[model samples]
Target: MIIFFFLQSKIFIACVLMNLLIALCCFHFC
Candidate 1:
């Protein structure tokens, strides 16, 4: 159970980072 929650949080963070990167790219390019 603890391991599953850890993995879920890791994935959530990765998704948030990806979104931030995309937004930054868009803001810089457009």
Candidate 2:
């Protein structure tokens, strides 16, 4: 149970980081 929750949070962080990166790229290029 603990491992499952940890993995979920890790994935959420990764997704947020990815979104930030994408937004920065769009802002710089467009």
Candidate 3:
């Protein structure tokens, strides 16, 4: 259970970082 939660949190953080990167790219180009 703890291992599963850790993986989930890692995925969540990755998703957030991806979204932030996309937003930065849009702001720079558009």
Candidate 4:
């Protein structure tokens, strides 16, 4: 159960970070 939560949060954080990075890159180019 603890490990599942840890992985879930990590994945969520990673997704958010990647989303932000993609938005920033698009904004910079456009």
TM-score for each predicted model, relative to the true structure: 0.97, 0.93, 0.96, 0.93
Candidate 2, residues 1-30: lDDT per residue as tens digits? 999999999999999999999999999999
Report residue 9 deviation for candidate 4 (angstroms).
0.1
- What local distance difference test score does each model get? 1.00, 1.00, 1.00, 1.00
Mind giving the per-residue lDDT tens digits that candidate 1 earns over 1-30? Answer: 999999999999999999999999999999
| Per-candidate count of clashing residue pairs (backbone under 3 Å) | 0, 0, 0, 0
Taking the tens digit of each residue's C-alpha lDDT, what string does model 3 give over 1-30?
A: 999999999999999999999999999999
lDDT of 4 by residue, 1-30 (tens): 999999999999999999999999999999
| Weakest lDDT window of 10 consecutive positions for candidate 4 | 1-10
TM-score of 2: 0.93
| Pairs that collide, model 3 | none
Instruction: Give me the candidate number with maximum TM-score.
Output: 1
Worst 10 residues of 1 by lDDT: 1-10
Worst 10 residues of 3 by lDDT: 21-30
Off by over 4 Å in 4: none
